[model samples]
Target chain A: DQQVKQNSPSLSVQEGRISILNCDYTNSMFDYFLWYKKYPAEGPTFLISISSIKDKNEDGRFTVFLNKSAKHLSLHIVPSQPGDSAVYFCAAGKGGSNYKLTFGKGTLLTVNP
Target chain B: GAGVSQSPSNKVTEKGKDVELRCDPISGHTALYWYRQSLGQGLEFLIYFQGNSAPDKSGLPSDRFSAERTGGSVSTLTIQRTQQEDSAVYLCASSSRAGLNTEAFFGQGTRLTVV
Candidate 1:
């Protein structure tokens, strides 16, 4: 069973435009959500994350929005750049910080310069 | 290095052969986890170790897969009589602690190819 799902396999956007990636989860017990970005031949790196209590969290150009009632979340990269192209995975965990995370299949984002 | 380290970045082994993958987590992190990403698939949890507590082996795909952390630092994941389906990029991660506020750091991953 895929508790976390990123339905889109890939997305393409123009540089300096807004890029949004969506994710949905079936497990409501998951209270913490995270986004990770991976480049070819490299391990995934943490991006932005949001806690259940909050609806949005922003760091520089990346922002994450969580809707508990919808069991969904999205990562928005404003003014997307070519370097932002990569595979983005959505992960969720229960019991807060020290929990095992369930990951989505990932969505590959390509930004054209 | 400040980041998690994984050895044998690439390994090609014949089917039925056993393989051992190693991981060295950040120096002070106490929570270690193992995950694997198959081709066109998401990261699948494998196992987890936290301090002296019993490791969580629930995510292991089969009896042929096993991992152990020695001295609470370096970890080794061993696959016995591996199958082609076992080929994937095995990743290791570590966190200062497992809980609400900590984030895990991952290694580059060991890519295993079973031919």
Candidate 2:
């Protein structure tokens, strides 16, 4: 009964290329979606987020797109650098219960030089 | 501290032993949360505490798990008679407030291994 799912276990991309990571969710009550990047031996850091009301949100090189109808979302990193390599976790939470986050298994992204 | 702090980065305890993990949230944060991450699995919510209200214990897996927050600041998670399945990285996080879409800052986590 996983409410969120990251179908791809891993993704690889060349330097300066665009890398896309996808995630899906089964719970319609989730109105807020967040992406967190985690390095080895460290806690996850917030990347970007999107509300169900918006289709897309962009910050610097990172962009997140959401499709409420499809119950899907994707993270895009343009000009991906080697530093961008890490595990990306997609988490969802309802507005009412913002403290509880349902996370996916996560997708490991590797950017090669 | 500038960020959430979790003590005992790693701990190994024998089966049936009790263990206590501690978490220190940011100075003014009013919300704290506990989560567990098993190998190859996603983060699982365990419990949450918000501004003096009754803590949400719904996510706690069993009676063996319990947590308490003192003075709305520090929090401690206690596991009684730990089992092998209790092994996991226990994480603590805090936000300015709860139910506001605020991002929670996390600690490095305490890795608990039950042998």
DockQ of each: 0.58, 0.62
Query: Interface RMSD, all models, one decimal each?
Result: 2.7, 2.2
Give a tens-digit lDDT track for model 1, residues B16-87.
Answer: 999999999999889999999999888988999999999999899999999999999999999999999999
For model 1, what is the C-alpha lDDT against the true structure? 0.92
Error of 2 at A30 (Å): 1.6
Error of 2 at A104 (Å): 0.3
Stretches off by above 4 angstroms in model 1 are: B99-103
User: What are the models' TM-scores?
Assistant: 0.93, 0.95
By summed lDDT, which 10 consecutive residues of candidate 2 chain A come out lowest?
A: A92-101
Candidate 2 TM-score on chain B: 0.96
Q: Is the docking of candidate 1 incorrect, acceptable, medium or high quality?
A: medium
What RMSD, rounded to one decimal, does every model reach? 1.8, 1.5
Model 1, A1-113: lDDT tens per residue?
Answer: 88999999999999999999999999989999999999998888889889899999999999999999999999999989999999999999887744577889999999999
- Off by more than 4 A, model 2: B99-103
TM-score of chain A of 2: 0.97
Per-residue accuracy of model 2 over A10-112 as CA lDDT, tens digit each: 9999999999999999999999998989898887778888888899999999999999999999999998999999999999998655668899999999999
